[model samples]
Target: MTRFSANLGFLWTDRPLPDAIRAAKAAGFDAVECHWPYDTPASEVKRALVETGLPMLGLNTVRGDVGAGQMGLSALPGRRDDAVSAIEQAVSYADETGTKAVHVMAGISEGAEAEAIFIENLSVACDLAMRRRLTILIEPLNAFDAPGYFLRCTQQAKSLIEHVNAPNLKLMFDCYHVGRTEVDVPTTLNKMMPVIGHVQFAAVPDRGPPDHGDVDYRPIFSQIAGLGWDQPLGAEYKPGGDTDASLGWMVKFR
Candidate 1:
């Protein structure tokens, strides 16, 4: 069966992180993940995980200066210090909460400089996470949603992972982003499965529930299962209204 992880970042936004973790358990999710949980203390998050017995699959590094339009820091030139700080913070939190991975966000930028800075920052992230026996992940955001975001394609992410040369560093193959930017989802997934550390999905174009998307996830989920991916696939969609009301798809998908 294709188990799912509720992405607390988007799933249960109305409540606290601890509360959201419990809600995911009640909703039958096998695991949980988040975007940025820095504001919520690690102790509280840890307590909730212990209470619910749901593994925290992963979480993203902080997006630096949202007010300044910075989505991430690692890829921005002249911001290596900030990026390293974000990566360290994320790894520490993940370690405390028993999370398995950290998604190092590459902020908006482009060209050779951005790529170099990104790789440098990723090396730092990988080294820090390796100490905790945690995986470091890089995700390719779709151009439409994240224009100018440094990492924008699976090929680019794969090449960077190779260049970084860290075994713990891997790709976060978000199906919705790839489906929006690439030609075929399963083919791309099949080709990239060897380096994939995690997977996520949402409705393409709409970023809603997978059940009502341009890309059908049923076959893709089965394909992943066949490929020996035993971890819970991440549900990172935005619930149009109350998150509870939007969970019908989970039942059907499961």
Candidate 2:
């Protein structure tokens, strides 16, 4: 059972928020996820989730800077307070909406010192996340997608999860980013599967639907299916054209 989560942040962009939920439900996604509801009221989002009867997957915490400069500050020095506070707010949101997973990235490090600080800060956030009954998903962005990002490789993410030694903290494998950084998808996934808590996908280069790019999703998908990964496989790609038009290939997979 390869259950997929339709990313409302990218899919159904033209439709209203509620409509997006309905559309994803009809599209056969087992659940639906989106970025943080900064503009939309949580009540509205909650209503949509209830109406569609879809589980919420990933939700983001507020970054220290909303502007162009900051990615996130989860592990930076002097930002520990802000980082914890951000997760707290996200917990409040998640608690209300029954969302149990939060993606927490340590914003890019400026240097070795910053990297160490970020690791310490993330260690604290992990504890808090556990207390809140939420799973913390740490994503490692490739240098191409996010230059100067603190965690740039799956190896680094794996080390952090190991060092933290917390059960609730795990890695977020964004297949698109990993595909840009590594050559083999199935091999890389096998290497990082233990730490990987959530999985997302997008076509290479274009970051669109799975079939639109060179990455062969069939094998990658089959690999996970063999692993008995019953949770949702997040479809977190941007639609190059009409969302429905781009998703035609997935009908057979259903």
Candidate 3:
């Protein structure tokens, strides 16, 4: 059976984190994930998780100073210390909340120096995450949604993972971004499965619910299962209507 994770970051924005979690459980989701829950008290989030018996799949490191247009710190030059601090903070949060993984953002950076900085920062992150038995994931965002973002392609992410050379480092293969940034999503997914730690989905172009996307996820789900991936597929889409109403596609999977 294909399990689904409701990404609380996109869904249930109108409610509190704990309420969102409860909603996911009531909505028949197998698990939950989020973008950043740092603002919420850890004790409260933990209580919700315990109450619902749902695990938080993953969360991202802070997008460094979002108001300043800084997306992430990991690849920014002269921000190596800041990057490591962010990773450490995320790992600590994961440890407290029982989140299984952390996606280290690379920010809006480029060039060889940025790549090198990313590798160095990722190595440090992997080390910290490994100690907590948490997987460290790197996701490739599409340029359209995240222009100037340091990581924008799975191939680039793969190469960075290779360079970092950490067992705990893995890819967060977001099918939506793949559909937007690259061709042949199925082939790319098949090629990258071995290194994938998590998977997320949303509609291409509009970032809406998967049921209305250019990519047909039915066969894509089969392909993932064919590769023996047993984790829940994250629904990281913006609701076209009510978040609850947008979950009609989930009926087939359930």
Candidate 4:
């Protein structure tokens, strides 16, 4: 059966993180994930998870200085110290919340120097997460949505994972980004499934619900299931109106 996870980062933004977890549970989601939850204490988040009995699939490392347009720190040259700090903080938080993975965001930058910095930081992240038996995920944000983001394609992410050679490091294959950048979601997914730690989806052009988009997800979901991926697919779409109203698409999966 195809299960789904509500990404609290986009869904239920009207409520608190803990409340959102309960909402996901109430909505019949199998799991939940988030972007950044540092603002909410780990204990409180854990309490909600415990109450709801839904696993926290993953969370991202802090995006350094949003005010400065810095989306992440891991790939920024000369910011190794900050990147390491962000990784440690994310790992600690994930540990406290019983989360399964950490998406190490590669901030805006490009070049051999930036790649080297990202690899160095990822090594550190993988080591820290391995201690907790947690997976470290690296996502490829499309150029349109995240111009200059160091890791921008599955091939690039695959090379990094192979170069790092860490068992704990994996890829976060988001369908929307893949559709925008690579243009062939199913083939890319099949080729990259070996290293995929997580998967997410949204409408291709608007990033809205997956039910209606440039890319039809029915066959894609079927393909993922056919490939033996039993884990819940993360729903990371923006709800144009009330989140509850946007949930009509979820009924098909259920």
Clashing pairs in 3: none
What tens-digit string does per-residue lDDT give for candidate 4 at 87-200? 999999999999999999999999999999999999999999999999999999999989888888999999999999999999999999999999999999999999999999
lDDT of each: 0.93, 0.80, 0.92, 0.95
- Deviation in Å, model 4, residue 177 alpha carbon: 0.4
TM-score of 4: 0.99
Q: Which RMSD does model 3 reach against the true structure? A: 0.9
Q: Which residue ranges in model 4 land beyond 4 Å of their true spot?
A: none
Ranking by TM-score: 4, 1, 3, 2
lDDT of 2 by residue, 23-100 (tens): 999877889887766567778778988998998887877766757667787867778888778877777777677776
After superposing candidate 1 on the true structure, give the runs of residues whose Cα lies further than 4 Å from its correct spot. none
Q: Which ten residues in a row have the lowest lDDT in candidate 2?
A: 245-254
Each prediction's TM-score against the native? 0.98, 0.92, 0.98, 0.99
Off by over 4 Å in 3: none
Clash counts per candidate, in order, are 0, 3, 0, 0
- Per-residue lDDT for 1-254 in model 1, tens only? 77999999999999999999999999999999999998999999999999999999999999988998888999999998889999999999999999999999999999999999898999999999988999999999998998888888999999999999999999999999999999589999999998999999999879998997689888888899999999999999999999999999887877
lDDT of 3 by residue, 5-86 (tens): 9999999989999999999999999999998899999889999999999999999999989889988899999999999999
lDDT value for model 4: 0.95
Question: Which is the better candidate, 2 or 3, if ranked by lDDT?
Answer: 3
